[model samples]
Target chain A: LAKTTQPISMDSYEGQEVNITCSHNNIATNDYITWYQQFPSQGPRFIIQGYKTKVTNEVASLFIPADRKSSTLSLPRVSLSDTAVYYCLVLFSGTYKYIFGTGTRLKVLA
Target chain B: GAGVSQSPSNKVTEKGKDVELRCDPISGHTALYWYRQRLGQGLEFLIYFQGNSAPDKSGLPSDRFSAERTGESVSTLTIQRTQQEDSAVYLCASSQGQGLYEQYFGPGTRLTVT
Candidate 1:
């Protein structure tokens, strides 16, 4: 099982870049790292996914080093709307199961 | 196309009562998942169903919780003798396939046990 850990909370001002890192010391070789953002009273929404290196989508970017033991989610020029709980999940390909972390609460102040 | 949807946006039940929650996945989705989220907590995997395979109940908290799915279309999660600890948001998600695909989530059903 690939258990992930992230910071409990973070605060960032509007228009600033925010980076949330997750540690997964036991990540498997075929495990894929994915990120999800959730707002109050709503289900989580997918943000980005990556196996290694970096993957940038319209909403966010995911960075993973060679060891694949950790990854970082980068949100550029965050706004108030970006305030939500972000979770780092490890997708086990063999079992097709997802293990979610406690998540990082990001508060973007305007 | 419509996304994943759950019924009875909110449900409140008394202790020791039985409650059932429903989930409707996307049209062609082959994988469905159930999860629970407590107040200010991350999602907890409950169960998973893929096509006609046996539903994965490894994540279920106890025998009081059971789920069933019919032909990958709809799924129902039943909690028997509900307790205060079962009070949380029950979420449903579906994906095109079980692999490394993106999961679309529903609004979720808030289950309140009093």
Candidate 2:
């Protein structure tokens, strides 16, 4: 599995855009970049996923550079309820396992 | 319209006891997964099942942990001789299939062993 590195925590206020980046230098050609949001005492929810370039959904957007070695999750007009831990995972090829790193904790302040 | 569901939302057991955690995936979902989240720690991959085929048990922490899925609907994770270290939330998720699908997770079963 590809190892990912991200910030431990981040702070933001409501109505501001929050961007979290993840680095996966050993990403494989068949690997996909996926992001999950986890609130306290709940399971991680899927936010966005992308193989390359950009993919936008109703909730968030994922931007992957041409190199596919890194990706960014962009959330617009954040609110206090958006405070949660964001995980960037690299799904292994032909396997059921996805390696999750420490993840970036986004604290949305009022 | 129902999402994934897990039974025994919270379980308290003694050491050396056995516990079973159940997961009901969304209807039509073919891929199911099991993960463990210890306090102050990241999610740990446990196992994955696709349809009725053999599950990938490589991620299981020890021989004491095991899981079984019936058809493509329900799964049960069994822990034998549970230890204090087994205290954590066990999460279950299901996806449409491989490549680019978003996984839907259940609320999970919080197990505490004393």
Top-lDDT candidate index = 1
lDDT, candidate 2, B1-114, per-residue tens: 389999999999999999999999999999999999998778888988887789878899999999999998899999999999999999999989855678899999999999
Q: How many residue pairs in model 1 have overlapping backbones?
A: 0
Over B1-113, each residue of candidate 1 has an lDDT whose tens digit, in order, gives 48999998999999999999999999999999999999888999888888999987878999999999999799999999999999999999999988588999999999999
Q: What is the lDDT of residue B13 in candidate 2?
A: 99
Q: How would you encode candidate 1's per-residue C-alpha lDDT over A1-110 as one tens digit per residue?
A: 65789999999999999999999888889899999999999999999999999999999999999999999999999999999999998876666668898899999998
- Estimate, for each residue in A42-104, the C-alpha lDDT of model 2 and write its tens digit: 889888888999999999999999998889999999999999999998887755468776789
Candidate topping TM-score = 1
Q: Point out where model 1 deviates above 4 Å.
A: A94-96
Candidates' RMSD to native: 1.1, 1.5
Error of 1 at A27 (Å): 0.7
TM-score of each: 0.97, 0.95
